[model samples]
Target: MRVLFASTRGSGHFHPLIPFIDACTARGDDVLVVAPPGLEASLAAREQPYRIGGEPPRDELTRVMKRVLELAPDEGVSLMTTEVFGRLGVAAMLPALEEVCRTWRPDLVLHEAYEFASVVAAERQGIAHARVAVSAARFSRSTDALLATVLEPYGPGITERLRTSPYLTRLPASLDPSPYAVTHRYHEPSRPGALPDRWGGSAEPLVYITLGTEAGAMPTATALYRAVLEAVSGLPVRILLTAGRGTDLRGLGPLPPHAHVEAWVPQADVLGSASLVVCHGGSGTVFGALAAGVPLVCVPLFADQPANARLVAGAGAGLAVTPTGGPADDSAVLGPDDVSRIRSAAELLLKDPSYRARAGRLADEMRATTPCRELIGTLDPHS
Candidate 1:
């Protein structure tokens, strides 16, 4: 069988599709990727053939994204879903992506939840397709209406195809149960790798901090970074902060000797040793922390991070402290009070054992999920 995997430019949307793609390739199936040029470096490393799916012009994208950040998180998600993915993305990439579907004629098309072009193109071409979720939130409430409008060009009942299609996800169902049924639960992709060189197997509690891949580029990130550093200041725990790829450490100014700063670190390597994780509540970090049985202190910025944070907090696995008011107001500045709250939350989690116990239980539940590789056979359109 031949499989065509598709995603937009963002890392959050792209990572969830990897395990399934790798599963298809490992079985000797022909595979190709459909993505934009910004992701070439990431795709090149996969060593598979890919056609560049052109994206919206940069000026238009920048104009819209600027407005998105200025709005509250919910509003940001709404506009982003309708304009960015629903209209701009489809208008920009559909022609090229649909052409690929018509030409490549792969056995199946798989796409992340937000990559609207692929599913629409697959629908237009009558190809088999599936939806791979990036987060446990499932995006049902958020995307249903937008998809209904965006999917109309292909034909009637396009939304039904998405509904009945094979759905794969890494949803830790017990922690954040979906309102709808989860067709299949898949484990997060992981590989053993060396920890950051600055880390020295410290016996003291290790607090891992990461803002995910794209958060640093947000206008609000600088203040959040400063606040996170300040929140952990004077704490007894040793800090290991991954600043995301291409981040310049010098921009962060001086750091404490006890805090280890690196542009990148093997998350799997550090999660096992971390006593607690502080993050932007991106699904990757939230899910990774839970799977490793490490509690999280989530400072959600936008998108689904606030919900992810709340679920982690509600489950007693960790705390959620949004310096920017999270979904309420994205443009709000991080104040000292917010920083203190983060500090207090971090301290409480470290001082208490209940959080870790709950996190460990969630980890056990996630580990019991079927691996993505095991689900490849289930994608066959013909029963």
Candidate 2:
């Protein structure tokens, strides 16, 4: 069976699909990943070749907002919803998607739930398609129904039209296939050489700090980095920071002897050995941390991040922080006062064992939830 996987342009959006693609290929099925131009190079470094498309500018907020309005214009949804929609809008790469489908004529189209274009295009061609949800809770039937109702006010027939659309043919929103099946299992490996030398032979607790690939390029990235640095100051732990390309790490100004800073490092490698993770709460990062059995300190910068962070904290596996002051007291929005709060939360997780214990248990539950392979079998029984 030939499968064409369409992903959004950013690395944060594209990386999670890797394991699933590898899984399909291992089963003797041909898999082709399609994304914007420079994305293919990133995939190539991981030894995966993906077809390239037109380059989309790296305006995370603007692009995401545009996609949400395109999907459900009436809903007064937050930026979080827009971000989720934008990620899903990757399906809007119609020219590239149409080309790939015509050439490869894949037996099925598998895509991120947020990328609704694939489902529409697949429906038009009468091919089977399934969505890989980026975040938890968003895929549930209850949520879908609620979102549909919310979007109904935007356009008279939009919600009804989507309900009957070929995109969600058989399976309900909540039970879609996820690629994190194997990732939820913890497997420790030696740290990579590319990691900072200080990472070598460290007995102190390890805190993994990353804001994800795309959001890491935002203007707020530097502020968040400083907050993290301040939060971890004087702690007897090794800090490993990955400032994605285009970030100005120079402002960090001479890291502590115990801290290590780099442009990028293999996340799986770092997570495999990490004791805790401090991240921007991207779906991939959260799932990756959960898979590694590490607790999270989610600093949601925008979009679905706040929602994702709330879910993680609600699940008892982590804490959520935001940049805006809101009723959700559990989260610390970015500000002068938030620095101490962020530090306090990180310290609490480190000092208290209960947080780790709860995180570990959730990790097990996540691992046992469902396997993408089985889900794929259901999607294409003949294959």
Candidate 3:
């Protein structure tokens, strides 16, 4: 069997596809990938390449994203879904992607959510394709809407086909259960690295802070970071904050004595010993924290982040600070009270054992998920 994998660029989006790709290669299937020049280089795939580079022009994407960022977090998802990922993405990726499908003629095209070109190309070429979920379950409606709107010109039932296709996800059923009938829930196959105990058996808890790579580029995230640092100040626990590469460290000013900032961390390693996590509620971070059984203080920046935050809070695994136009109380919109809430929430999570207990339960669910390697037979044509 031959499989082609497609996804948006970035670690968060790209990492979820690893399980499927690794499964295909482990079974001796030939594979090709369409993605940014990052870890995909390490993926085992066929040598011949497709130069699939038609991302929206930088200026236009920037102009559109400017408007997207300006809108209240709730108002932007539609525009982001319709334009950025839908219209622009289709125009940019479809031609070259379709050519790849026609040329390579793989038996299957597996894609991560938020990437539609591969699905369309597979439909056009009459090849089988499946989608892997990269976030919480609430996305299918908006995602289905986006595909329906973009796929009209190509053919009928393309959207419906995707809506009912085999779905794969790493999200535990407790987080956001899949609505799909043919869903396969599983954990990624890679083993987590060991975390070296810096304290050498000292009893102090470790708090992990990561706002995700995209956060570094956003000014809103800068303010959120400062607020989180200030909020956690004077706490007995030690803090390790991973400031993504794009963040303006100078803009963050001085850090509290208990907190140490870095460009990145071995996330799985850090989470191994972390007692609590403060993050932007990205799927990867939220998922990682849950898998590690670490509680969270989620301050959503945009997109599905707020949903992930609410999920964590609702599940009793963490607290969420979301946006509102109110004069006081709310994050990203109103200011100081948000920090107070974060502090209060963090304190509550640290002191009470319930939150950690709930998180541990979720972690058990995560580990119990069927291994991705076992599901490959379902997609493998030779089987």
* TM-scores of the candidates in the order shown: 0.94, 0.76, 0.91
Candidate 2 overall lDDT versus native: 0.63
- Clashing residue pairs for model 2: 80-303, 80-304, 88-114, 88-115, 139-174, 140-174, 322-333, 323-334
| CA-only RMSD, every prediction | 2.6, 6.5, 3.0
Per-residue alpha-carbon lDDT of model 3 for 1-383, expressed as tens digits? 88888877666777788767777778787778876334344443534333443788889988989999889776687777778877787778887788889998889888887788888899988888888887786665555665677777778888888887788887788778777878888886445787655444556788888888777667676776777887787688888888887787777798776677877777888988789998889988998889888999998878889888989999999999774423644345436777788778889999999999999999899889888877767776556
Which window of 10 residues has the lowest lDDT sum in candidate 3? 41-50
- Over the full model, what C-alpha lDDT does candidate 1 score relative to the true structure? 0.81
Residue pairs in clash, model 3: none
Better of 2 and 3 by TM-score: 3
By TM-score, who's the top model here?
1
lDDT of 1 by residue, 261-357 (tens): 8777767899978899999899988888888889999988788898889889999999999764433545446677788898999999999999999
lDDT of 3: 0.79
C-alpha displacement of 85 in model 1, angstroms? 0.9
Task: Provide the overall lDDT of each model, using Cα atoms, as 2-decimal numbers.
Answer: 0.81, 0.63, 0.79
